[model samples]
Structure formats: C-alpha cells, structure tokens
Target: MSNKATLIRIAEAAGVSISTVDRVVNSRGGVSPDTEAKVLEWATRLNLDRRLFRSHLRTLRVAVMMQSPHNPFFEALRDAFSDLNLTMADLRITSFVHYIDVNDFAGTSRKIEQVAAGYDGLIVTCPNDPKISEALRRVSRKIPIVTLVTDLPDSGRIAYVGSNNRQTGRVAGELMGRFLGGEGGDILLVLGLQRMAGHEEREMGFRSVLRERFPSCRIVAALESGENRERAGQVVLDALREYPGIRGIYNVSAGNSAIVQAIGSLGLTHKIVLITHELTEARRQMLLDGALDAVIDQNPRLEAQRALEVLGRNFQRGESGTTGGEYTPFQIFIRENCPTISY
Candidate 1:
C-alpha cells in the first residue's frame, strides 16, 4: 500500500512542527517569515492541497442599505454588486438590501441599526439625520462601515464610494449658464432630498458657480420633491406659476421624470434649459427627446464596483485601502453624446 503524505509529513520534510505548517496553511499567526516560506514550498512539492483550508478563511457578510430598489439607478447598482459577487472567487459576499421611504430618516435609521448587527460590514446611503449618523457610529465600533452614494456628515465612516458631487454640480451650473448665453432670469431648482449630502453639495456648488460666474442669473427658489416624481412635477408647476420668468431648471436628484413631465405640459421644451444628475433610462430618454438639456452622470456600475473593491481591500488589510486618486470620471451627457438607455 502506498502512503499519502499529510500536512505533518510536509512539515517534517520542511524541518518544522505540525503547528507551524497549520499556521502557514490556514494563514494564521506566529510563524517566522523564513519558516513560513519553507513550509509552503514543501507543502506545494508534496501536493498538500489547501483547497479545504478555505474553511478557515473568514467569510465577510456585508449589507447594502438604500432606498427602494424600484428606481433604475438603485437597480443598476444592485446588478453591479451581484455581478461582482459572481466574479470574486476568494471572498464570499452576502448583500442585504433594505428599502426605506426616501424621506423617512427615522425609519431608515432604525433599519440600518437592525441590519448592521448581523453583518460584518455595511455599505449604506446616508439617511440624513443625527440618529442615523449615531447608529452608523455605534455599529462602526464593531465592524467596518462604508458609505455609498451619499455621505453622513461627521460620521467616522471608513470610506466613501461616490463621485465628487460638488464638482458635478458646478459642471451643471456652468453648462446651464453657457446654454443660457449669459441671459438674466430666475431659475427654478428642483431637488429630491435636501439632507442627502450629494444633493446638498450639488445644489451648493451649482448655486455658488452660478452666483459667481453668472451674476445676472438668479436661482429664485429651491424646492424639495420628497423623492417623488409627481411631487417634483407639482413643485415645478407651482414654481413656474409663481415665477413666470424662470429661464432654466436644475434637477439635483432622481425626479427628472417629474421635471420632464412638467416642462412638457407647459410646452416649454425649447424655452427653458434643463440640466440634471444621473443617466438613468428616463433621463437618457429625456435627453433624446430634447426635454432635458444635459445630465451629470456618476456611473452607478463603476461606483458599485469601487465599493466592493474598497470593502474587499479593507477585509484583506484590516484597514481602509489607499485611494489611487484615479476614479471613473464623472461624465457629462448631452443630446450629442448621450448613450442609449438600455434600462
């Protein structure tokens, strides 16, 4: 009968104890660098396969909390993360999705606290409230937390995976100003949630740039649409009625559908310069239909991939990974170069 070499046999050949071999094979602690290398070499030569050793590998379960999955943008992000899970062979990723009414901060915070308990890590869109931030902080003390899409102010999150929203906003403002040809008139700003850091930064950057560069153009009013398309449409309708001289509109969130509908109903397609964020199907169609002037896209697929990469790196290193600084560039989509919407 032929004898099969065991892990102990490999350790003996490498002149080390079985415990040392165990440490090297299981990727545990307390092995000298030279001894670890020798043990690995001997194990490889003996074909001491370590595939079973993966049972000892730590499994990372992460939760991704966001608003309703019905939105195409969130759906795209979910799809991207799912694809990432299929591709990563070394790590096991479990994604937990929670749907919260976009404007209900308290409900979102409670959900976050609940899910944060079961997972090793969290990837979340901020809920824009102190309670949510407190919940994130409390949970972060136990596990790593990554902020996705929107950021929580003063929250000691590990990393933020999203675009430079303020820069994108400035770009929108610049485009709006140029499209207006320096003409002076009131502009209506339709927003989804004011407390979302992304939305807030975008609005602030847009306002700052427009005020400084195009002094004549005035943003007369900014209204929150509560993340509802119908509400957004109603708000725009009210704004148009209130400010008859509105020459441009800036949409800083997901209510582009409402903006387009309101503008269409008013028959002001060619009259107002409309700019918005995100490149969802609706926005792309609006751009194609000439109802929307331009869109500042954050590229949800890239953002999703980056979030996973960051979490994976943090798991491997036991700390936040380095920012390579180079990121998927924020894209400016206009009618001339906008991609066809598949969703």
Candidate 2:
C-alpha cells in the first residue's frame, strides 16, 4: 500500500482520526501508547518510507480556554486569534472556547478536568484558586500548558502570555500619585474581581508602589464590583459617601465606566486623575473627554498574536520558551497612544 493509504488504514484500525494519527507520528502532542505502538507496527509492516512518512505527518491542534466571550477584551483576543494566518502545510489551528464564571473555582476546575483529555496544548487564564492550579498540573502531565492573562504561581505551566501586572500597578499608582499632586489625600482602589490573578497582582503592585513612594495618600478602602457596571458605580458611590475626602481612584480591573459615572455624579471630572487598565471603548472616550487621566493597556492584539505564535511554535517544534516566570511588561496607555478600536 502507498504511505498515505497505510497511514489511513492504521488510523482506521486505531479508531482515531487521521489528524490524531499524524500527531502520534510527529510526537507533537499526547496519544495513547497502544495507539502509537499500533501505528508504528503498521508502518513497519507496510515498509512505508520513513522520510516520506515523517515529511507528510504535519498537523497541530491547540485549545484556548478562556473566560466569558461577553467581555470585549477577550472578544478582541478571540477575533485576533481567528485572524491569524499561520499558512503552513503541517499546521492546523483549532481553538476551543470555554466560558466560566471568573469567580467560581469549583466550576472552572470541573470544566478544566473535563476538557483535559482531548487537547494537545492549552492556553488558559488561570483561576485564582489552588484547585484550578492542581487541575492544570494534572493535565500538564500529558500536554504542554500556557497561562494567559492571569497566572498560577504554583502550577507547572510552561509559559505565560500577558502583561507585567505589577509594573502596570506601579504605573497606575505613579499616575495617581502624581496626578493627585501629593500623598495627603484619600484614594479608593476599585477592583473588578479579586479572584483574578491579574487584578490581584495589579492591586499588589499599586499598593506597594503607593506605600513606598506616596505614603501620605491613604488607600481609604477597596471594594469589589464583580465586573458589573451598575455594581461598580454603586460601590464607588458608597466609597465616596463613606470616605468624603476621596481625591483619587485606581481601578485595577474592568468597570471603569461605572467609576467614571460615580466620579461625574460627584462632579470630580478633571479634578482627580483616574487611572485604570484596559483601554476599552468607554475608557478611551472618557480619556478623550478629559474624564480619565491614564490607562494601562496590555496590547490585546500583541497578546493574541503572541499566544498563537507560541502555540504554532509548539506544534512545529514541540516546545516554547515565551514565559520564564518573570513579570512581563504591561503597555502604558494614555489618550495620546491608545490604539484605535475597530469595533
């Protein structure tokens, strides 16, 4: 039989798709040893050309596991990935989208465990709990894993693709400190969700920088807004009422619109330098309208491109070195350099 015919026959006998057979032949991802042995035995029995077989066996599959598709930032990322053109003969990219409540550890963990069996590589936003970390570790035994946006410090993930959250925090803190014109006034730290590792790191970095550089500015209180605009607005309103001297605000997560509304309600426009992350549509408008002073943006396009490149490299060479367990730089954005939003 011809080489392709032999491969197809072996794949049929193994009860797996041709792509799975290709993966086994190339050692790109995980396949059962029995399946691998069967394919190898068939190749030997058929005396298929080793060089020809290796040359023709080229296909890679990767899974991208993320949070809600409803979020514009993640939606942008998804669109970016779909737009990638890794036009190579041996590479086939497939993305699997999963939506889990960012705050639900158990639910996320269950989903991870469920999907861990089928994928060759994983790109995921790490949940802020040990259970999810443990689940990732369990899966890494079989396939390479990469963390996206957020990180799991203890998980044996191969690389991370996201911003240097601490630096982002420090940048926000510096902007707030300078814009507030000193450390004597009160500032509120608003977070979208404390369970997100990205938010947690940003908060830490912001607080660390503020404490060291601007000790006079007290962080009056922090409240979680759960990424809800209404909740965020309400939280800021409550904080404003509770701490009447609030002069500045640092948002380490989403829900910036609500914060802006609360500030406008109090008529603090241009009076306080507001700093946040992710230059979404509302944030860009607010900055343009002079309601927001600065924003720390992690380039979603670059992040998405890097993610696809990492996966592509892994599929091509079975390895990647993008993440070295150090803080990656978070891009700083103001009204001046914010990239124009397409949709």
Candidate 3:
C-alpha cells in the first residue's frame, strides 16, 4: 500500500486525524498512550513498514516500585529490573527501580503519585493500602499500570505479573506437613504485613491446607515480622518459648536469616522443620546447612521480564488486546535440588 493509503487506514481505524497519525508515525510525540496504542495496533494490522514502526517508536519510561532493598527478595527484584533494562534497549524501553517504604502508608502513596507522573508505565508491588490504591487508580487514568509480585486487584492495574501466591502457601503447607512425618505438631507462621494481598492469600492458603489435610497439625502462633530481621527474631524467639511443641515454622515473607538465628540460639535447629519463600543466597546457604528444610520460591528475573513484556504489549496493542494477569511458575527448593548460583 502507498504511504498515503496506509496513513488513511490507520487514521480511520484509530479515529484520529491524518495529521495526528502522522505525528504518531513519525514519532513527533503529541499522542496519548491510548491513542498511540490504537494507531500502532492499526499500523501493525495494515502491515505498515516494520522498519518505520521499529525505528520511529517513542521511548517508554517504566518505573518499577517495590519495597526497600533491605529485604533480600526485594533486592533481587531490583537487580532483576536493572539487568533486564540493559537488554530491552531495542524496544526503546527504560526501566527505573523506585523504592517505597511500605512501613509508611501515606508516604508510599505520595511517592507513587509522584513517580506515576514521570513515567509512561509502572510495575508495583505494595501493600493494599487505601491511599495507595487510590493513587494507583488516579494515575492509571493517564498511564498503564502493572502490579508485580503482589497484586491489588481493584487498584485499576492493567495486569498482575507474579506467581499464584495462594497456591504457593498451599504447597508450603503440604511440604511442612509431610516433613513433620505424619506426627502432627504445632506450626508457627511468621508472615509479612497482613495488608499485602500476596501475604494474606498465602497465609489463608497455608492455614486451610493444614486444617483440611493435616488435622493433627495446629497453628499455635502467627507472628507479623513486618519483614524486619530483628523483629522477626524477637517474635519467633518469644513464640518458641510460649509454644514449645511447635515442630514446624513457615516464614511467609522475609527475615529467613533472623528465623535461623533464633532457632539456632535455642538449639532447636535440628528439631524444627523450617520452610520459607525466595531462594536468596542467605536462604540457599541455610538450606544447604540444614537450617531450612524447604523453600517455596519464584523467579524474580522472570517476573521482572514478564512485567516489562506486559507493559510493552499494552503499549503496542492497546487495552483491547492486552489487559490480564500472568502467573509465573513457582518452584520448591530443597537442599538437594536447589541450583548453585551467585544470585
């Protein structure tokens, strides 16, 4: 088709003026994301020159927001985003990792609003706070938003890129039950904030599995570590003192190191069956050393890649073609099966 004919078709399909399509096609940068996505979808469908599409595409700045890197899991996620950023230059995609202090809900909400204004898209993993959800809903009106790791289903996000958190919890429960060798014993749950949907789902799943499948196993105590190492250790030590029969421990969020230390200080490392999430270096070492029996893990690198891909698809195909959640696969890591890697 002639250039003029192609322009006409795209303009008609996108319901924009030919001059608007011209600006978008030539990368003059006056179009909104929604309109640009429409034009690009039409251009792709009409088989417009691939070179033109690729060479003239606008640069997309994506902000990846998560908790502070003090937590090993969030630190790994930050690294994943940084590493992936180097390889997505061909797509003209630039990702910036932004840390939010989940401990301060109001501050986190304000930070999200500020970051949203500066980026074309966002990938966030935050607590399900009312203020944060409201901020996300407000910013989503102007730019695409994808929830990562944890999900806020009602927060106006285009998609959630992560594993099935509930299933992860269920798997952890099964492992804990089986590792206890059929003799039911007290189990302790050390979890992150209850406001994080992912953590909540995991706790519920873990509890349900124990109740239905392993009736002999009882959750003697549930502690909120708030992802703090010192706090995790203190709470866990206290719980152990209170519930001496606790034979299994599930670390749902972070602070694996603290949990290990607590168990070791009490000389209960050999007696407790410990399972946690994320196979970070510290956790891997613990697993190998018999401090932890198993880990319910997910790939942060893959999740980061998929989050960016989801944003890219939304930018290219518009809301009609791209708006859904993706469940990244989770793995069970034992000392024998865990891969040896620097990460």
Candidate 4:
C-alpha cells in the first residue's frame, strides 16, 4: 500500500477494480453513478489528492421536505435540519425546509418538480408512490438526492439517512419476546399507513424475527390507520375486544398516544406488552407511568444531521460518507434508560 493512496488502494477501499477506479478518477467514462460515487468516497477518505474527481465546494442549495406538518417528530427533524451549522468536506450549506402532505402524492410531486431546477440537492421523506418516485428520478438526474425517514429507493436517490427500520423491528421483537417470558400469544402490529416503505420493512423484520425465534407468538393482524390517532385508538380497542389471546402489541408507526389511550381505557396498562415508535411527550409520560413496555425511537435531529452530511458528501466528493450511506442509528428506550429531555 502506498503512503499516499494510489488507484489500487482506492479501488480496494471502494471494493471495485483498479480499472473502474481509473475510469472514475481520470474521468475515462464507462462507470455507473453509484460506483463512481463509491470510488470518490474512498478517494476522499484516503486523502489521495485526486482533486480531478472532486468538485469545487460551493454553496449547496438544499431543499428538505419532511413528514406531514401534524407530526411533531417530523417537525423537530425539519427544525434540526435547518438549524444545523455543521459542515463536512468544507462545504457551506444553506437548507430550506418544506412541509408536504405525505398522502397527497400528486401535490407532493408538484412540489418536488417546482423545486427541482432551483435546488442543488434535495432531502425528502416522501411516500413510496410511483409518480413521486418518477419525479425524484427525474430530479436526481440533475442533482443528488438524499432520502430521509421514508426511502424511495427506486427513485435513484444518491443516499438514505434514516432508521434501519427492519433492524429496529427486530430489536422490538427481541425485547418484546424477552418481556413475554415464553408466555407466547398473539400480537398486533398497528401501522400509521399501509405499505409505507419504512413501516413495511419494520413489519417484515419484526414478523421474521418473531417467527424465527418465537414461533408460538402469532401476529394476528397488521392494521393501518393512515396515522389517524382516533382510528389507531379504535383499532387498538377493537383488537383488544376481539382477540382475547393477544398479550403483546407493536405499533410500527405513529399515533402512539392514541394507542396508549386505548390501552389505558382497556385497563391493559400492565396486562399487555406495548411497543411503539417515537419518543414524543405522550410516550415519555406513558413510559414514566409504566403504561408501556418499550419505545423504539429514531432521533429526528440525528437523521437530519446525517442527511445534511450525506448530501454534502454526495455533491462534493461524489459519495455519501455517513456510515456507508446508511445513517441515524435507532434507539430502544424504556423507562429505565429514557432521557428526560424536552423535544
């Protein structure tokens, strides 16, 4: 290995062939965008002095569209994304946050299209709809895109900075199983919306783990309520009333407070094992009152920070450096280790 990174070293670091590295570093062509970005990421990390492949860092006009305006967690995420003064690779960043109706696919697509030409980079938490994906694909042709929270992988975004939903789900399963202590019974997965990529992944992971490790635990139903609190509450109440054998619940999406209310109304504060997402104030109090079992939280501030970092790296170094393009580690909070902080 050379003290200064050579083409071979960069190729090895990037897990590509030397010729591919040569093509990317020398702009010789015949390299896919993802491969080029990975090579440049290695070059940047290795300090290889390959300035030819690196762009001159400029003010990045970044537009960030977070979750629905009604979601405080998403609101916090947006606030953090805009307020950060942090930088990576010496690039100056100016972020503009946009709120969109996650369900309004057409309106969201219009918003994306309107901002497409004006922004240098886009960070969005959009629905996994075909039209929205098409719009992102079109925009990504001109500027790099970093998906936040919800991923639009088919959209060809450069990188993602959000929870490893599947792993978080597995974490939930492991914890919930341990809490159940072999008294296996049915559980419910309440989703804020059906088929949201993030929620789907989490459900898959949770179900897979439960099947693999706890065969006796049955997932009776996977319900969706569009994140409507009242509907979520009703679903919970109905599930409780209908299923007498259910001993555990995993809410894979929003409306944690509503679920908690249903649990309280059913007087299941101690009888049922509840695992939900987000560490909002309602959830914090429930955890304190011991009304819930566990809360799976992905910090919006961290997600925002990683999104900005990846966006910077994507445009400047042609790579998204934050944890190999996966970022914002998820946390499992209980009353014992929960931090007492006001969001």
Candidate 5:
C-alpha cells in the first residue's frame, strides 16, 4: 500500500479526504491554508514520516455577532470571547466580536452575509426574524454556525449553546410571586426585544408559572425597551403612572439600569418586588442595595466556552449536522448569595 493510504486515520481524524491529506503532507499546495493547517496538525500528531511542514499552520478566524455594548450582558459576552481568543492560540482559533443593531433586520442580515464571508465559523445572538434566519441559513452552507443565548431552529445552524430561557422566565415568575407574599398585584414586564425568541420564551414561561401557580398575580403590560436605558426607564415610568397597582416587576432583557432608575425616581424602590436577568455589576449592586430582589443569570462566559467547543468539534469532524441544542445551566442570585466576583 502507498504511504498515503496508511494516512487514512489522520485524514479521518482531521475530517478530510486521504487525497487532501496527501496533498497537505506532500506540500503540493492544493488545499486552502486552513485545510492544510488542519491536515498538517493531524499528520504531526500521528507521527507520519512522509513530508511534514510545520510552518503551514494557519489561524482559524471565528466571527461572533451579538447586540450592542449598551447591554451589559452582550458586553460581558464580547469580553468572554475576547478572553477566550487570548487563550485559544493553541487551537489556532481567533474570535472577532461584532455588534449589530437587532432592530434593523435588513442591515443586520446584510452584515451577517458580509462578515461571514471572511470567517471560518460564526457564533451569533440575534432575534428570531425571518431575514436573520435566512441569512444564517445561507451562511451555514459555507461554514458552521452556532446560535448563542437564543435558538434559531430553522436557521440551518449547527447548534444552540445557551440557557433554557423559558425555564429562566418561569423561575422569575415564581420568585416575583413569592416575593410579593401572595398579596397579588399587577406585575410589569420590561423586555429587551420583542423579536428575540429567548425573551418571548421567557415571557411565556413567566406567564405560565403565574397562571398556574400564582393566580393572584397578573401581567399588566409587557413593554419592549429595545435594550435602551432611557427608553426602558420612560416606558417603566409611564407604566407605573398608568397602572398604579403594579407591585411586581421583571425584566427579561437588558436596560436593568433604567428599570432601577425609574423605580427609584418614582420612590418605589423598596415598595415593589423586582427581578431582572443577568448578574452584571450594576445588577449585582442593585441586588446588594435592596433595589433588585433577585437576578437570574445565564453565564455568558460558559456559553462562549460551550459555543467554541461545539465549533471546534465541528471543525475537527469536518462535517455538519443538527446536533440539537445545548442548554447551559442558569443561576438564581439573591442579595445573600450573589457572587462578589465580576463575570
């Protein structure tokens, strides 16, 4: 058998054809730089003794698309990816973070198409809009895509790595109800984006729990803040003015700062039971100061790690198929148990 034939294990391990491996091993220069690098890495690991070039290794570029830094959660998520990039040199993976305006569907879709052309893989957190999904599906045809913090089930993405938002919302509902001590007053919901599937799922779960377990509590209104602090604060303030009986509050997305400010502005800081998502520094401080009652945190760092793992696995396997969703665990934090470390 030819020496190249014996390299089948390496080819399989690297998710490439034996002929491709042969070309990379012989330095014939037919494969893409990344393909060559992957093949060479596997060949080196296998100790193949034909012709190996260590200098052909190439860094794999990964694109991460998320919301603007106005939201602390996305900012933390961007930082998580940045930190991973520093340490992922061994894997030849580098991640670039990009923020997109979730409200502009056409612009966001175009951005994905343009940015995806230069990257080997994509990890994104966008609304569940048809345009965005179609963009993702089109991009998935060329490279692997992983949905972060939300699921785009029909987007042809490889996997979703984030928290079960529905369960998260349900937890918030129960906490709000219990915190209200069964007095049962109208509750106000401040959501980030109405198009975000995670936010909607959270709303569903919250409503379900309230309907089944806490019948006395009712949702007065669900206002979309678009993750804008000023808008969040104004809508919250208006809701308070309109619904004088609103005694409980839950924010399914960002704008927690605005929520706190609005509540405090109205002198209802200690009078209302409030729960918000994510354990940002601001939110943590609010919890400590008795401004926020509790926080349901979906750790962005963990999600980043998991999404990278999924991409790494897909690259090594050299194939893509729906692997279903990977649900990261969520944490509920109260003043007494909130962590002191910044995430």
Candidate 6:
C-alpha cells in the first residue's frame, strides 16, 4: 500500500532482474512481448499509474510578456529574468518570455490574450492601454496574473513586484535639482514611451517633486525618445535646439546614450546635470566621466526573483507573505558609489 516506488520491489514482483525492471519502468524496450505485458500488468495493479503518480507534483507554465528589445534597461532585465528562469527547477515552473513591439499597443494586447490560453499564469510589464488591461481581466479569470516592472492598477492582478516608479522619479528629480546647484534653470524630462504606466508614473513623480520642492527648477519640456539610440539622440538634439535654456535632464527611460550625446554636443556635459535610470556599463562610464551625475536603479535581478516567488506561491495556493503588492526597493547611485558591473 506504500505510494513510494522502489526498484527492488518492482524487480521481485515481476520476477525479473533489476536491470529488466529499470528498462520496463523507464520504457527502455528490451524485454520479450510477453514479459513486457506481464511487467506492465503487475505495475498497474501495484498502483504504478504514471499519470496519477505525478498528479500532486505540478508543472506551472508562466508566460512573461516583456518589452521591446530596444530598451537597454529592459535588455538587462531580460538577462536577469532568464537566469531566474534557470533557477526555478525545484518549483516546477517554466518561463516563456515574449517580447512585444513598443509601438504596437493593439498587437501587445492580442498577444497577451493568446498567450494566456496556453499558460497557467502570466507575468507582464504592464502597459497603460486599457485594451491590454481588458485583455488581462478576461484572461486572469482563468489563471493567476503577476504584474512585473510596471503595474496595471485596475486590472485585478494578484500582485505587483517591482520598484515604485513614482518614487524612482521623485528621487531622480530631487537629485537632478540638487546637483544643478539649486539655481533656477529649465529642466528636461525624456521618456522612451509616453503610454507606459511605469514611465508615466515616473514623469508624474518627477514633475510633482520639482514643482513642490525645487521651485527654482522648471521642467521646460518633456518629450519622447524612441527606443533606439539614434532616434533618441535626434529627438533630444531637436529638443535641445528648441529649448536652449535646459539646465538639467532626467531620463525616465533607456535613452541615456542619446541624451548624453546631445548634451556633449552642446558642451553642457558639466554645466547641466544628468540623471537617468539603470546602471549599464555605458551609464557607469558616463558616471565616472562626469557625463551623468546620478542613477536610479530598481535591481532587476531582485525584481525577477521576487516575481517568481509571487507566482510560485500563487500556483501552490500558499500565502505570498504580503497583504497586497510587493515592491522591490530602489537604489540611488552617484559617481563614487556606482558599481562597475551591470545587473
């Protein structure tokens, strides 16, 4: 009556060698037809039902809807998520990573709905579009939903695991202001996508802090920097030309290279303060070279790991150790403290 299977018992009952039992159990196919039938007959009667054997050991398939490949920060986050996927073997979880075009909001929504049908759960970097939110609502009725990096407030996701973007924005704004020497000067806010809930929250936080705390610093312009460096650089250059009074830049997205290039072209690298998110090698070098003054990073590795924890708990029907959303703390790095490695 024991549920646990043992090779010795199987071999004795089948009147076969351990090797034959091993072959039979593993489907290695060397026994005669009559012997194979006998082994299978006994195995079934002994409660060696393979499908039922694993009914309690579940496999949870989770689909991860991430961002376009163009954002360097997301690229780093992708790597972290991949590594985390490799470590989930013990939890019986597998990650299916899918990238959505940054410009195609409708396509992203469709993909989410399609992916939901195949996966047991979903983890997405939430988009601001209501279409995507509606898709999530429809799909989450069947499976659990965990919103990563970004969050969909009204979407009834089980939990959110990421840094608070608004706070990240506020920190960036405060740093940019203080680093600008507190003298009244126009500031620029650049983002990769305006419709991203994460970026919008960051912009909101940056604007609110600047308005309330840094009265001297004015946000003269807030513009989009396309995902690519070239497009981002061009947008920044045109913004620079249009707003020559810009004294500081707070990049809420992954266009730091373009913004840095434009600032360098205008010979304002040292004169104007630069604060961006993430700590890529390029950003680290920029920090060392005085091109960028501060960086706000939501440790992607931690975020990825926490995301798995939440999903794993949900799949097991266990407590997630939190009442509501869980946020990975953000880190602020200056030139002196910025680590040389990228995460």
151-196 per-residue lDDT for model 5 (tens digits): 8888999999999999999999999889987779899998989799
lDDT of 4 at 261: 83
Computed on alpha carbons, the lDDT of every model, listed in order, comes to 0.77, 0.74, 0.87, 0.78, 0.87, 0.78
Model 2, 1-343: lDDT tens digits are 5657766876776678888778877778687777776666555444455554554443456677787766668777777666653432234556665667777888888888788677777878856788999998888777777787888766668777788877788888888888776545898999888888888888998899888988888899988988766888899888988988888888776677878888789877677668887777878888788788887777666776576666665654445434554334566677787667733
What are the runs in model 2 whose C-alpha is more than 4 Å off? 1-55, 85-91, 320-329, 337-343
For candidate 1, lDDT tens digit of each residue in 134-171?
87888888887778787774566778888887888899
Off by over 4 Å in 5: 1-56
How would the candidate models be sorted by TM-score, starting from the highest?
3, 5, 1, 6, 4, 2
lDDT of 3: 0.87
Residue 213 CA error for candidate 3 (Å)? 0.6
The runs of at least 3 residues in candidate 6 whose Cα sits more than 4 Å from the true structure, single-residue gaps closed, are: 1-56, 318-323
Better of 5 and 6 by TM-score: 5
Runs in model 4 deviating more than 4 A are 1-58, 85-90, 318-324
Candidate 3 lDDT at 231 equals 94
Off by over 4 Å in 3: 1-49, 320-322
Model 6 lDDT on a 0 to 1 scale: 0.78
lDDT of 4 by residue, 126-224 (tens): 878999999998988888888888777888788877888788888888887888878788898898765478888888889888989988888998898
lDDT (tens digit, per residue) of candidate 6 on 1-343: 3423565565678898778766766677788878766665455455454443232354778888888656777777788777876776666678878998767879988999988899988889956888888988888788888889888876668888899888898888788778776686998888878888888999999998888888999988888865566777787788888999988888777778777888889887787788888888889899999988898877888887788888876655433323377888888888899887876
Ranking by lDDT: 3, 5, 4, 6, 1, 2
Q: Where does candidate 6 have its weakest 10-residue lDDT segment? A: 47-56
Error of 1 at 187 (Å): 0.6
What digit string (tens of lDDT, one per residue) describes model 3 on residues 23-77? Answer: 9878899889898888887886665664567765668899999998998888888
